[model samples]
Structures are given as structure tokens and as C-alpha cells.
Target: MSDITIRHNPDRERFEVLDAGNVIGKAAYKEYDGGASPQRIFYHTVINEEYGGQGLAGKLATVALDETVAAGIAIVPVCPFIKKFLTKHPEYSANTAATTPAHPEFLNEPSPRARA
Candidate 1:
């Protein structure tokens, strides 16, 4: 919806998509310093149950990722949804900072959507 507003709170490390004054969806992540610059670790993605299956989560993720990427920040998707999204959109893999993390199992297995 054109009226939906996605806002990011850097201090809280969360982003929310509001629809007509109601927060219908939200995605949250923690920023890791990694001894260099901070990299966002996508930890959670949730769309209000009422808003589920409407693609709101995807929209939230897109905006959040775009905003961070525009600011030159890399991302690590620890959330299953986000990992699946990145896997389906290999083009976005370029935005990922680490192909391998201290615990690689944390990453959600990539999807074949983009490859299809």
C-alpha cells in the first residue's frame, strides 16, 4: 500500500511497516561491530497474523535491506525468512558481508526460486 510507511530505528535495531497508523509488520536485527564496521544481523521478521500471507513481510524486508544497503552497510540474515529471501534473490547475495560466519549453520538454506 502506498500509504504504508516503513521506519527504521537504528538505536533499537528494528524496522516497522505501519499501515494507516497501525503497525502491521516488523523486522528486527542486531548490529554486530565485527571489529570493523557494524553489520546488520537479520534476526526476526514478523507480520501481524492478520496481515500474514499478504506479502507485507517481503515488503518490510525489501525496504529495510534497501535502506541499509544504500547507506553502505552489509547484512547477515539469521532469520529464516530473510535467508530464504536472499537465497531466492541471488542478486542480493552481493549485499552480504560474510559468506561464512563463526557458525555457518545459522544461515537459512538458500532457496531455488531465483535460480528457477
Candidate 2:
């Protein structure tokens, strides 16, 4: 993990984790207005099989949430990993939002995936 780097790719609407310049995994999400604050609803996360068993996913989650807060955005942890991570890190509680039925519905609407 010496060469690991986490980069945010907004056009693709995800944060990517690269090891030595190759993408090893990603945490994907969709963002929209969440009333109190704009929200990044993380719905899926995966670390390439070969890269599993390490703590890369946690590292990715850390940076992703850090950046989300830096950008003045709130995190909606629909993804299990993200949800679990938040539970362990209560410091982020203030920046997190609980999921609502409409959050999932928004993900299904046509416009969210139009950029892909």
C-alpha cells in the first residue's frame, strides 16, 4: 500500500483507490439535495478480490468522508461498509444523515446515471 492514492472522480461520481497507479477498488455514490445539506449517498463499495483482506476499504472510506465534509456535503451511508465505518467513528456523526425512502428512490431516477 506504499503507493496508494485516493482520488475523487466527480464526473464518474465515485471515489477511486489506486495502488501504484492502478485502480484497485472504488466506492460509488449518487449526490443530490438532501434538504439540510447536499448529500452523497454511497450505495456500493468494493475492493478488487486480489486486494481484499487488507484495510484498503477503510482507508478509502476515511478519505471519502473527510473530503465529503471538506466540501460541505453530508454523507448518507447506504452502503454497508460506509454505514459500519460511521458507527465506529462517532466523530463523523455530525456530518452524517440517516437514509430515507426517497434517497433510494432518487438513485433510481433517470438523471442520476445519465453521466455514466
Candidate 3:
């Protein structure tokens, strides 16, 4: 555990958790026109290898999901870690206006593809 700070940079459109001064985890989002309105999509997020398996990624996702809910944005869990996290924690599922596609079929691998 370290002195961590969680912050969302709207300018860069990313949610991050910092340890001391370095970013330990982050979730990135992008906006696009979804027919009649703008949609914020959670694209990707990563926890630094040094901080892996310590639950920092979950913390980052929770904070990001909270912020997205406050802003009234629909969620898209593009990152496998985030998808798995959501599966385990259904509380955050309320933040989403619509559910994302089913969790990627190959999520059991140690490193899952996120760039889809």
C-alpha cells in the first residue's frame, strides 16, 4: 500500500490512480456520436506491473465507474480486466445504461487482448 491518489483527467479523458507521483492504474475512455447523443465508452485500463494483483485496478475501475454514473454516461468495458471486475462486482453494473457485450471468451489467459 502506498500514498495513492485517484483522479480523473477530463482533458485527457482518463481516470487514474497515482502512487506517490507515478500512475499505478488508469482507465481510458473515448466519446463518439451514438445516433442522437454522445456516448462515453470505457476503452481500456491498466494497473502497473509493479502494483499488479494488489487490487489497485479494481479501485481504479470503481472510481471511474462512480464518476461515469455521476455524469450519466453508458459504460463499455473494453478492457478484459474491467469486464471481469464488473462480473464480480455487480454493484457497479447499475451505473451502466446498457450492458456491454459478454465478457471476452478468452479472459482466462494471464494477458488478454484489449485493443478491440
Scored by lDDT, the top model is: 2
Query: Candidate 2 lDDT (Cα, whole model)?
Result: 0.90
Residue 55's C-alpha lDDT in candidate 3? 80
Ten-residue segment with the worst summed lDDT in candidate 1?
A: 103-112
lDDT of 2 by residue, 2-100 (tens): 688899989888999998999889999888795777999999998999888889999899989999999999999999999999999999999998899
Q: TM-score of model 1 relative to the true fold?
A: 0.77
TM-score of 3: 0.74
In model 3, the worst 10-residue window by lDDT is 103-112
Predicted model with the maximum TM-score: 2
| lDDT by residue (tens digit), candidate 1, 15-45 | 9989897777778876665536557788889
RMSD of 2: 1.8
lDDT of 2 at 13: 86
* Ranked candidates (TM-score, high to low): 2, 1, 3
Residue 57 shift from truth in candidate 1, angstroms: 0.7
Those runs of model 3 whose alpha carbons end farther than 4 Å from true positions after fitting are 35-37, 97-116
Off by over 4 Å in 1: 1-3, 99-116
lDDT of 2 at 76: 94
lDDT of 3 by residue, 1-116 (tens): 77998999887779998989787778987654442444566768888898888888878888888888777776667767777888998887765534334322222223322443
